[model samples]
Target: KVPTWTFHFQRSKRQRDDDALVLPQNQKNPKASRIAYKIEEYNPLLDSSNITPKDWAKIGKDIENNYMDYDGFVILHGTDTMAYTASALSFMCEHLRKPVIITGSQVPIYDVQNDGIENLLVALLIAGTYDIPEVGLYFHDKLYRGNRVTKVDAESFGAFSSPNLAPLVSTGVNITVNWNIVWRDKYQQRFQVSTEMNQNVGLLRLFPGITATTVRAFLQPPIEGVILETYGSGNAPDKDKALLDALKEATDSGVIIVNCTQCLRGTVSLTYATGAALKKAGVLPGADMTPEAALTKLSYVLAKKDLTLEEKKWVLFKNLRGEMTDAAGEPKLCLSDSRFIQAIAKSLSLSCTEELGAVRDALTPSLACAAAKTGDIEALEALKQLGSHLFFGDYDGRTPLHVACCEGNLNAVQYLLSQGATVHAKDRYGATPLSNAVHFRHKEVVELLRETGAHLSRDELDEAGVELCSLAASGDLEGLKLWILAGADLTKPGPDGQNVLQVAQSAGQKEVVATFSSCS
Candidate 1:
């Protein structure tokens, strides 16, 4: 299904050791013959660290020169500084419409147990077949956006991770591509290469007891940009007047200072007084961009000879090339609508369904229960359209509505009730959906059920109390709290004649026991 042309860059540690060229023909296990491709290895391979702005230009030129000839490009690179190269290339190749997969392995290809061959094979397949027209790193069975990846391991095959963004594709028995999250340009643009990256940018990480002299020296002249890796959420020492003055001096002189969080997961927020001080010092928030993306982007923006320093700073905050996420710009969801239909389809493994008949047959009782548990109206509608019985119950006599109430899926309970689902369906334990909702302490679900004239008789209330005691014994603190709020009788004995406190104590649920004691 795919053709391949392999280009080797002579910068990886494995390649430097002269181990990558030793093919399996000379090895004891020659079974590597099954892995086939139309290979074209280029000359003058350079190590990744030796790669610079000029090398990035050369790679971009090569891809642009051959853009019309090949469907995709596969680059074999060293793991060290691979993220840097990936980030740089992502900016250089503008309006890219063909896959540019960068991949490498911890072990050399010469080793029989090496991961190199598989990584190469998968990269080739992804580039050739998939329409992922962007720079990506395919390592260990996961394909990550080039700008979002970081190498976290040195000895294992699964060495790279993308903390902020999810993987573009995951390869296993079936290649699972998460189409929803894949970055796609709204309008097609002409492919062009921009290799002129200014090498004057630098990265400065703040440490404990870091002096102002050190910060000032790092942001000195000729460094047009500096990525200041600040404390959690981009906070630095506000009390350190010397450090603040140094940062102010850098910005006063027109040097762009971008504040990024030193921590891996969160974004930079200027809500804290200390963080707000940094903003006052002319340090722009880098949002949630990784250190790699921040540094490379700074270099790319600074190289724009046509733009002024202020213009470059303005462009840095913009989401160019999908490098940063604007957290405040996300839209709010309305629960009454079909906002969760796609998610329901994904959870039900129905994303690949092409026909309505297929959608109908796939809506098994288990699937219906799953959809109900999540309160997916779109999925339920699809099932109902396919002639699925809305009152369908599982082996335990628990219908879709019953499971929805137990899981506190208020939206699902409301939708099922509107769709004529029986309000008083009982499970094998003689527990109705209302009793289940009460036992679980699902306040929203209980309220919604009660509004629909769903009620529990005295016997049902007694059974629900027993279920609440069992939940207490299992250390379900939230469930116990909810049950109590719903007027569940804590004094009611469980099936074993133990009160809620006694059952919780016997099961070593100390927190539940404490909660029960507090309630009493």
Candidate 2:
């Protein structure tokens, strides 16, 4: 069991054996400064020392009944069953209007160097102040809604993450809230407590040789609901009729069986034969909903008094609290390695400018040129598949060669030069590849461009002044050195009326400033 507030309270009681244990004196509520608040100390469910689960429930009921007496409730519990408790209370507390932030630390609270104090303090602050009515788990300084969370790691300090969902609050020096992502139940405002959970809900994991006997046990008379975790995209063998029949019987008998994926990314649809078989067998596809969300939601719906069985089944598959996404008509973009499959798959490619880049007719020579221009090696490879000759011009009328030189892509510049690119090819502005190479301080590319007999006239030096000064202004020392060595007339003033050295000095390039000092 996880060490909680009771552990600390017990220790305090032991140290001061004579006096009745009292909580730290009341502190001012951080939310509405007018209100003063006191901590409500209670025994945790996992406290084998004195309290049982019933005792803990009684305490929870007391707080839920008399919630107006206090601003919020803070619970410290063992991490093992914290989710169960949080999920139970989410249904038990009906229209909750105040924060009931549950938190636990891996280390004991009494430890001098522990995360407990900070977590407790922050949870208390949020609970006492924020109008968060839903149950939430605060761990490692991040606040996540109780239902959407899973304990991903057991030993790490950062043990929990809401993978399919965004965290409600992220903590640094200040707790930054993603208010747009918070979950609110408009229908749940008028609080109603429903705690009767169908404990017979079966959680079945699909694995190799998962036979009739394995699934048969879960579909037995006792179980009322089932959360079936299926293989990629909710597929099961059509050959398995026994499992199919069992599911069909359960669903026909008013049992709610939800189908979720074992994978972290992607969702299931009733498109394929295998998925359709399960759907026909009365298994509802929980599109993109985590197993935790599905289980609790089923528990919630099963406990509701008003909804009929059909209504409950409909609600299970539909979006509630942003847990599941509505289906899109077209199949989702897949990244599977299967060629025989009719799935849509696209590779991720990033350009040098951090834009998501895509290639049209990816295996074409022209696509290679486009990739070279954007400095995307993957796209370049795809482009090479079509033909040897590849070339693309940017908006500036600069070819792949010009972009390569400017961006210091030595390999791309070399490849372009090797591919019969004219050494003296000038851009729309009449600036050659060597001019860009020198201006960008790509010495190696500049050397190669010069080896290809790249030329720049004395008149071109005047035009080069504007581009060279821009590089210098950005403290590009390498570009400045290349231009100076490549016969760029530093003595010439730029169109901006500032020389390279003046640009460097004004931009705080002390080394470039010193280098240009000698030239001036």
Candidate 3:
């Protein structure tokens, strides 16, 4: 029952007229399709049509009419104006209840590996049957509310993301829905579109030694609002009276001046005296809102001429959807909820739900060194919660599985694995979970890990770094045999250019040395 439309606009011939035609390869061969629209190109955000306003209006009306008669709508739009179109649709389409999902791919439909098919398939699925409507955007396996999406990465296929908003849903082998977050307004939740945007909104990124003349021109009579990209978590130079005076003059003339941070995370607070000056001048903080979100939100709020200016301010400060968090923020605690742990568990191919607590419990070891050092089952559970924090300070580093294997904590080892730890994890030293256990003298831990088919030998460690050599010098015969049986590379030499047999000899363990010789 879902109604879908593919709105394709012809690229304008004039170079300067098509402001939305910001594709990467602009060159066009006279005979073939313009290189700009060649879908095989790397950056799909650039592959946008240079549609004129008249054409867009026509397309919008056509889709809107068709949408009223159908259950949901999926639009195949050019990447360039996608965000703008999303913002525009948030107001333009009236009483929209069913999904009005917009999507585009990095490559054209003609390419063999074109991402268009997946994007289209997902969009159709969302529009065709998915409940909880409101304008939305779906692309590269993630669904975002249309109002919150922004095109960030130009080169990658997953170019668009709603940084201010959590994804409505994500797709893999099975589509996962974040049911709690999806928006559903009960009263009068029907399609009601309006298209009265005040094009007077503008953005200004402050730079060193900016002149009053530049600020004054944009803020004067014509513009109704201006978004100032401020420094740090929203600080402007108090030292510069010219900038301050210009901002004051603009706010005095009834133009709304909004302050937002140039940083990705964190909110804008005018905590400093200098910051106080900007707020005194009537500048408001846009707390954690992305520039794109700020711009579109401003456009959306301004479009509703029905709301008073004060009401607009109130709406901007609070979250309309899941666009922004609080003015102050903290690190996302890995253990507070088992959802992420559950996701990690599913990814690691685990089956038990009752035992899933072990993984969530293990995350605590990542918080404090003592929590992990205690060697208690609770401590090990805490460590599992620490997740990636155990192996590396940043999220990109090793997970808790690395810490357990490195210390040879068998309980922690089993818990991490059962909870969906990646057995193939390598620390900065490139040592696998099995390798770390062997080197750390936890023979039982190594044997248990070996059952999971973890990589065990030198060839497997061809890129195995120097730090792992020190662990191998532990002269663990049982650990070494466990690895050897699991298809370890015999040709890989240690730092001293010694094979496993030579490493055992150098470690002065006769029993280990003999075992290595027999294995060969």
Index of the highest-TM-score prediction: 1
Residue-by-residue lDDT tens digits, candidate 3, 384-420: 3444333222232445666666677777666555543
lDDT of 2 at 225: 86
Superposed Cα deviation of residue 406, candidate 1 (Å):
52
- Model 1 C-alpha RMSD to native: 25.5
Query: Candidate 2 regions off by >4 Å?
Result: 3-36, 43-60, 318-322, 325-520
Task: Give the total clashing residue pairs for model 3.
Answer: 26
Where does candidate 1 have its weakest 10-residue lDDT segment? Answer: 8-17
Q: lDDT of each model, Cα atoms only?
A: 0.74, 0.63, 0.60
Which model is ahead, 1 or 3, in terms of lDDT?
1
Taking every candidate in turn, the Cα RMSD to the unseen true structure, in Å, is 25.5, 23.2, 23.5
Each candidate's TM vs. the true structure? 0.60, 0.54, 0.53
* All candidates in order of lDDT, best leading: 1, 2, 3
Distance from true position, residue 324, model 3, in Å? Answer: 3.0
Tens digits of per-residue lDDT for model 2 on 60-153?
Answer: 5765564533445777766766655665566566545456777887676787877777887777666644445567888997988776667777
Model 2 Cα displacement at 64 (Å)?
A: 2.0
Clash count for candidate 2 is 3
